[model samples]
Target: MGIKSFQGARKHQQAGEEIPLKVSDYMTTKLITFKPDQSVEEVIDSLINNKISGGPVVNDKNELVGIISEGDCIKHISDSRYYNMPMDDDRIENRMVKNVETIDGNMNIFDAANKFLNEKRRRFPIVEAGKLVGQISQKDILKATMKLKSQNWKK
Candidate 1:
């Protein structure tokens, strides 16, 4: 006689039934945004107060214009010392990265992770209808992974 199996039959998941993990689900919606006219000194203050590396720069209409980070502020400070110029005179528009790359909210976390690795970026802004909706960081991806630790990752 064949040996009897003790374990119950495994359940198969239906196609498209399991919801994919998306970037929007883990992105931070309430962001500490900056303006182009703001001073580098102010940006430094906000970064320190919030304990963040950088923030998105937006216009009066809440449109993403650029991004400013600690690195940018540091460069501004260095230039100020070299040029013998006051630090307060420098504006974010001068130091901010105008060409910003954004990520789609609907993208799966795995694809987002690969993009992050390829881009070497700490965070990416999520835009909808040309408006800054949220931002996702490496830490957020880590959090998502931890949340799904018990589940198997789909290929």
Candidate 2:
């Protein structure tokens, strides 16, 4: 989506024609976070159990550190086979993407959607005070759109 469409959405909201949705409004607050020192097997298990493709990696203090994904796990497995190493020997810190992109909870839904389109990221950790507060995904944006479509607006 372009900035013009997003601006139009904001205008629609300002004119009381549509609901103004924010990232915090639809973001998944109950997040499944991982630690940098955690084992790759545990990360895979967490991803499977949580029914998510990836999760943020946080320190003990709950600070946003990195991100781990299914792709990262697969690469770990591949590297292990090539290097004759064991899967359990690797840690999330070794495989996780340290340079991460994050979003603010108060950001508009359209802006978040635009980021998803441009950045090509599956999910983003929502930060408050540099700490992980929640996560938003493309699916979440779709859900917000569905919610908006279901609403009966006043003329």
Candidate 3:
């Protein structure tokens, strides 16, 4: 789904009391991704350039291998400084979360929101057929919930 779909969903939801919203309706389809073999410096640059906290680590085939976040990157800074090595020496594969928790695009938004609350994660990679497709973030959930609340108020 795209931005238009999200708007449609929002409008439809506003017109009714209950309209089921799925992750696909709110998840971001455009993504900035990383590769496992990529240098930490490059990853950091990409993340910063994209104005994102992190991104999914995908293989050449676009398969989800891991996830990298600011938290993971922060944990390596001291070590790199102590070792007197460039951040480029660190590979994202070594720093990324290998056992990443992923969500399906068709998943219920409420379910995804619960996962965000319980896991305390900022974002989740949307996996379909073992490939990274999109992402959903805590901010996205917050926006969606706020929209829902506003729609409720219109009734």
Candidate 4:
């Protein structure tokens, strides 16, 4: 006199390998870069045309040397008027931030997001062997999050 089982047999779920999300996978490979000798006016034009806040400055070897932003361009314009110097005379080398911070391409997306939050930076350049490879922005992190919305977040 055993009780009858009404429910069907439970299906066994297979454990699948989870892939680690890396910054390089979500970073932008093609970038709008600037040269040290380029004029601030030209940088400003590129920034406006591209609708970007800033860009990286590289050397002849494509090595990251600095970063130039809208703030720098504005400062150059202000300084030009104050010093009575022509805006055309200003160079990216003088206006760009020389001591630039970069991030690794293999870093986890969560770690990269944390870095962006801690550093208060909109984007971080990815470098390998002293050469600029790509860049990851906050928007890219957001896109990654959206893409992984169904997956569990792991460290």
**Top-lDDT structure, candidate number:** 1
> Over the stretch 31-129, how does candidate 3's per-residue lDDT look in tens digits?
888999998888878878889999999999999999998878877887888888787788999999999888888887888989988999999989888
Question: For model 1, how does the per-residue alpha-carbon lDDT over 10-73 read when each residue is reduced to its tens digit?
Answer: 4555777664499999999999999999999999999999999999999998999999999999
lDDT to native, each model: 0.92, 0.88, 0.84, 0.91
Query: Of 1 and 4, which scores higher on lDDT?
Result: 1
Off by over 4 Å in 3: 1-20, 152-155
Candidate 1 wrongly placed segments (more than 4 Å) = 1-20
Worst 10 residues of 3 by lDDT: 7-16
What's model 4's overall lDDT?
0.91
Q: Each candidate: how many clashes? A: 0, 0, 0, 0
Quote each prediction's TM-score: 0.88, 0.84, 0.81, 0.87
lDDT of 2 by residue, 2-89 (tens): 5554323322344445465789999998988998999999999988987889999999989999999999999999999999999998
Supply the TM-score for candidate 2.
0.84
Model 3: lDDT to the true structure: 0.84
TM-score of 3: 0.81
TM-score winner: 1
Q: What local lDDT score does residue 74 receive in model 3, on the 0 to 100 scale?
A: 79
TM-score, candidate 1, is 0.88
